[model samples]
Target chain A: MTIRKTASDYSRSHEPIVWGLFSAGGVIVAFFIPALILLTSLLVQVGIADEAVLSFDRVQSFAQAWWGKLFILAVIALSLYHTVHRIHHGLHDVHIHIPDSLAIIIFYGGATVLSCLVFVWLLAIGW
Target chain B: MSTSEKTIYRKPYVQNQSASWWLKNKFYIWYMVREGTAIFVFLYALILMLGLLRLAQGEAAWNAWVASLSNPAYIVFHGIALIAAMYHVHTFFKMFPKVIVIRFGNWKMPESYLIAGQWVGFVVCTAVILGIGLFVGV
Candidate 1:
């Protein structure tokens, strides 16, 4: 007897999982990043924001807290996933051809590794 | 290998596109610009990661990291990043209404309201972050 394979035999795509993270990251970026950029960079340059606002003692204490660690991890990890997903697909827009599998491994894998590093670093900071 | 076990392959022709294809039209250019914002976002995240690493190193290292931001080049980069992030916000908010569908039973929420609500959320988030940084001491 001969067997036939239909579309259902194929495994599902992982696009949805990454796309969901990308959307969440987009919302985070839209709502939080401008103000963060202002606080970290432009305000400091123009002397409107005191450099001490980000002093080691204050920032360290904040980051050492459970909430602060969660907040930082969420922002960095989500943003990494969002941006790397964009950059991965953007390669095609510019006509830079690479195996899609390789691109996925490189971009998504890198984001995962970096996020893990951030989590580890946050723990090292301690409460 | 047996000849009957060999697989035959077919090659299909794909249209060749230039690397600068996006530069051909204004709309495409803007789309590319929107996508390009990812680079800035990625870099800023790296800066934060470096800051985190420095923070773990100790107060002196953290101070040095903060002081490094005072560089003229760093300021310029941040300025560009700020603009890019805002543009991202604009584009993202505009796209949100289409991406998410909301309705009240039979009554669907208008796109305008959805977009406006996002702006409200944005304002609230910005306020909270800035308020903490300014009044709460980081």
Candidate 2:
């Protein structure tokens, strides 16, 4: 027997909002994160990539550009939500009991605060 | 509402589980490892934020930040993070079809197709970023 959920039932839960961000962020991580790690850290260090790939002036100019700022913000903010959401649920799998409200505040709220900070820093970086 | 007449509700018993329960099963161990990638991702994000903070300070500060990444410890850390991120990509693509379904009329798109398309997208994205990093700068 199918027990259909009403619109009101959906609205009462935060699952949709958080799950949306989680999946979106997961896609971003899968597509972009490995490359980011390679570009920003590993390849250059190993001498397989040029040092100018992440030279101070190059990265600085990138951060100062509008699209570049948006890119940085999206990558950082979404990845934060993606990881924290997993960490929150992963805690439960490990039998650690955190009260729902408190967990939401700590994980989701913390992601939001950090995302805001990224946005602020991007703005501070200027165009 | 006299204190003697008030009834207290009893809670149901829940079986206690040790935090290391995942260690007992190979499948559970892999599951934990997959979830564990989040910690690496989170730490890397913090590192990027720190880089951004330093970038905002000045050229001297930014150069200092770049120099710091060359430290042996940070190189090791990034190596681990790079592996963790690749693992995340693998697990994410494996799980994506279950999360989102697509159908056209009577025929449904195969999960293999979805996974393959995602890989193509991932390769394209990686190439674009590599191009930008390698070619966009002076």
i-RMS, each model, one decimal: 1.2, 1.1
| lDDT (Cα, tens digit) per residue for candidate 1, span B40-138 | 999999998999999999999999999998999999999999999999998998898897889889998898998899889989999999899777955
What's the true lDDT of residue B8 in model 2? 70
Give candidate 1 regions above 4 Å deviation.
A1-11, B1-16
Best by DockQ: 1
lDDT of 1 at A47: 97
- Of candidate 1 chain A, the 10-residue stretch with the lowest lDDT total is A37-46
Binned by DockQ into CAPRI classes (incorrect, acceptable, medium, high), candidate 2 is medium
Error (Å) of candidate 2 at residue A82 is 0.4
lDDT of candidates 1 onward, in order:
0.90, 0.90
The interface RMSD value for candidate 2 stands at 1.1
TM-score of each: 0.89, 0.88
Model 2 misplaced regions, further than 4 Å: A1-11, B1-17
